[model samples]
Target: MRRNILPGLLIVLVAVIGNRLSPNFLDFAYLRDSATLVAELGLIAVGMNFIITSGNIDLSVGSNMVLTACITAKFMVGGMPAPLALLLGVGIGTLLGWLNGVLITYFRAPSFLITVATMAMYRGAAKALLGPQSVKAPSGIVGIDTQTFAGLTIPLLILLVTASIGAFVMQKTIFGSWVVAVGSNSRTALYSGVPVARVVRTSYTLTGFICGIAAMLMLSRLGLARHDLAMGSELDIITIVVVGGTAIQGGAANVIGSLLAFILIALLRSVMGVANFTAEYQMTIIGILLIGMVLANRLPLKLILQKLRPKSQRAP
Candidate 1:
């Protein structure tokens, strides 16, 4: 609990100070918009958390999002029902994810190299599928943007539900335990009879499913889908996952921590927007934050704090 509590407090502190530093950020609209942005990114970050915790990474998430969106646009343009289009998008994403899993598991390839290659392949395929033009979703499907319940945007609600389910799966279930075990030491887990390959494959498949969901939300927000949708977004997703305290080397991950990190990054973006900072500055800040968080995770700060406390007050 301390692990979760500390990072959460730090995130809140950053948000409060950031708002104070930028007067334009104190408004309700800014906060709502920021929340929506975080939710969108959080959807994928949660899935990435699972993949990373399983001792793997998926660089094709951004491309998956684009491909899903392109497929969704094509369906919608063909006058298909919204529900059908949505399902097709998710199906396409799941297949892509399964392909990744099969390639990595069967060929004994590094996940990093495999996903990097798929990332390019998926993006190129999306561009070819959608051609050089963009497709706009019908006004009815786009109307989801204006729909809300309980003071939350529909998209935000979807994000909340996805995060909640992800947190449950990663923290409370047998599968979650298996994920940590496999990630911490695959050979040991295998000796203990855990299905390492199955876990790893499922992680990638789930990641693709999440990417599909994110594509729908993005399509709603933009009211249009293009081959370039979510381009280079994999970097942002990876940054949030690391910033949230997920170990880059695999072993342990914090779902709530990743959620807080998602919020922090979104707040940073909102602040940048209000301050009119260049995109370069935003990227630089994210890069610095990622490096700092990774370094901090490697430190024995807790042990140092224990040492600094008064001997009389310390636990025996």
Candidate 2:
């Protein structure tokens, strides 16, 4: 309950501010439309939760997503079926994610450095494939943006579905437990017969697959694929996970928390945009938010509890 309070407060605060700025902000149609903008980033945030919870990070997520989208668009323009091209794109994402896992687990390199290098490499490769221009997607995919199911847009539906799956896996699966245990202590887990390497690989691979899904959604909404579809978005995704109470070191995460954080962020951005704030300034504000979260979390909870304790029950 406490974990959810911050995001809830943030949402209310943003809503209040937005109402003051624009009467149209609270309308159901406008809010639903805004969901489309956050869907792609939200998906990546959800995916990153798994990797972060399992004691790792992937800075290449933005590049991985763009690369997959670029590949998918290239195929679609080559007269391939949209569905088939999309599948291939997802497959590429999965493969890239698996590669990240393999390199990290087998080579024993730090995830931060490895992913950093791959981030540049993947983005460059994507640019090489798509050049400096936007590649338009086929009609089938371009039409996905306007798609709705039972009054919910396709991206929102997909976001909800992905979040549900993540929640289920984390709550009721052996794989989820392994990830937590590995992050808690790899040496102990390995000694206790847990397959640490496999767990790490699986976690990253899953993040990759989800990135693919997110890419397709982004492409559908934009109707064009670029070499920079999600450029530098890895920072926002990481911030979303960190702000959701996931530890950068390892262990502890909640999909719902991350989802709510994403919503708060999107709402804040919308309000800022309405106020005519520059995008560059918004990035700085978000960075400050991340730092504040980290600092507050680092505060001494025990000391606070001690201060709140009755004098009669005080310890030496």
Candidate 3:
């Protein structure tokens, strides 16, 4: 419990620092509006958490989002009904994810290398679909993120529901056990008949399916599709998962913590925005945070504990 609470405390500390940078950081409207816009990235972060917890990474998610959105846009432009067009986008995203799983498992390829290649492939395909220009989505289509219900915006509600189900699956099910076991030790999991391949495949596919949904939400919210949509988002998504206290080497995840991390990062970026920082500088700051989190794990626990202990208790 103390371990999980560490991240929560860090969130409070970051918020305090943000408020120091900009008084508007504490504004209710700023926070609420930020929460609504963050659901897109937050959704990807949730799925990436699942994949990372299962001992793999999907670098192609940004590309996956763009490709799905492009497909939906093409479908809509072709006179298809909006609902079916959106569903196809999700289905294609799942297939793309399944492709990643298949190649990694069957070919015994390095996950990092395979995903990197497909990341380009997927993004290129999206550009190919539109020939290097953005496509406007059907104007009559109402966005799920546009309205709030009972004091909660629809996109936020969707994210909460998604996270709740994900939390249950990750924390309460046999499959969750398999995922942790596989991540912690693949060979042992395979030897124990846990079907490591299936677990991994399921994780990647779930990521793709969620990205598909994210594509739908983004498409509706922006009313357009472009090959560049969500470009470079994979890094941001990974940053959220790692800073939330999930082990990069696998075996653990904190869903609620990731949500808080998303909010923390969002607030931090917004703070920088208010201070007139350029996007490049802001991303550099976040990149530093990501690296720090990864390196923090290398420190010995005794040293960390000693640093946390009172100086009076230290040896002379």
Candidate 4:
């Protein structure tokens, strides 16, 4: 409960600020549409929470989304059925994640290094495939994001459902326990019969799986697929995870907090947009937020405050 306060407060603050900036900002339709805009990032961030909780990271997710979307776009342009293309993209995404897992487990390498390399490889592959041109998204897949059910856009609905399921899995299941145990202390978990390698691998693969889904929605939303899609989005996703109060060094996961953080992020962006901030400014803000959260996690605030106090005022 305490962990969620910051993000929740930020949401309210952003909402208030946005309403002041743009009188229509609090409109239901506008908020709903804005939620759709963030669905892709939210999906990837949900998976990222799991990976971070398992004491691992994947810098390749943004690239994975682009590459998967590019592949699907290629198939669609080649006259393949939209459903088939979408399914293939998701399968490839899962396979890409599994590959990351295998390489990490086999080499006993840090995921950060492996994923950085894979991130470049994935982005390079997308660039090679498309080469400064975007493939046209197929008819069926193109408007999926615009479609509404129960007064909510399909993308937002997908996000809500996915987040709910992710929350349940992380909070209720034995697999969740395994992930937490491995993250908190791998050696101890291994001694206790936990499959540490499998947990790490699964977490990466799950991120890739979610990336695949995000890719499809992205393609639908943008009406095209290109190598440069979602460039540097990993920063925002990581910010959302970290701001949600997930420990950077692992051992904790906060699904609900992340959800609120996503809303806060969306609202902040909307506020910035209302105030006419450029994309560069938005990126700068996200960068600052990411750095601040990381430092906050590492810094001992209470101890620092204790040292700052005068000797006479300090506790014994």
For each candidate, give its TM-score against the true structure.
0.93, 0.95, 0.93, 0.93
Q: Tens digit of lDDT per residue, candidate 4, span 1-316?
A: 8778778877888899898888889998888887788789988999999999999888999999999999988988999988888899898888888888889988999999999999999999999999999899977777887789999999888888888888898889988888888889999999999999988888888888999899999999999988988888999899999998888788899987888888878888788888999989999999998898788777786799899999999999
lDDT measured at residue 290 in model 3 versus the true structure, 0 to 100: 86
RMSD of 4: 2.7
**Poorest stretch of ten by lDDT in candidate 3:** 1-10
Checking candidate 2 for backbone clashes, the offending pairs are none
The 10-residue segment with the lowest total lDDT in model 1: 1-10
> Candidate 4: lDDT over CA atoms?
0.88
Clashing pairs in model 3, backbone N/Cα/C closer than 3 A: none
Candidate 1, residues 175-261, lDDT tens digits: the string is 998999988998999999998888888888888888888888888888888887676677778888887878888889788777777
lDDT (CA) for every model shown?
A: 0.83, 0.85, 0.84, 0.88
What's the C-alpha lDDT at position 291 in model 4? 91
Give the per-residue lDDT of model 3 (tens digit) for 117-232: 99999999998889878898998775667687877778878888888788788899999889888889999999999998888888889989998988888888889999977767
Model 4 error, position 248 (Å): 1.0
What lDDT is reached at residue 106 by model 1? 86
Q: Per the 3 Å backbone cut-off, how many clashing residue pairs does candidate 4 have? A: 0
Task: Report the alpha-carbon TM-score of model 1 versus the true structure.
Answer: 0.93
Q: Candidate 2's residue-wise lDDT over 1-316, tens digit each? A: 5777777787899999999999889987677777678778888888898898888899999999999888888889999998788889889999989999999999999998999999999999998987889999887778575778888788988888888888788868988788888888889989999999999999899999998888888888898889967766887888888777777777777788888888888788788888999977878878888888778778887799899999899899
Over all chains combined, what TM-score does candidate 3 have? 0.93
Runs of candidate 1 with Cα error greater than 4 angstroms are 311-316
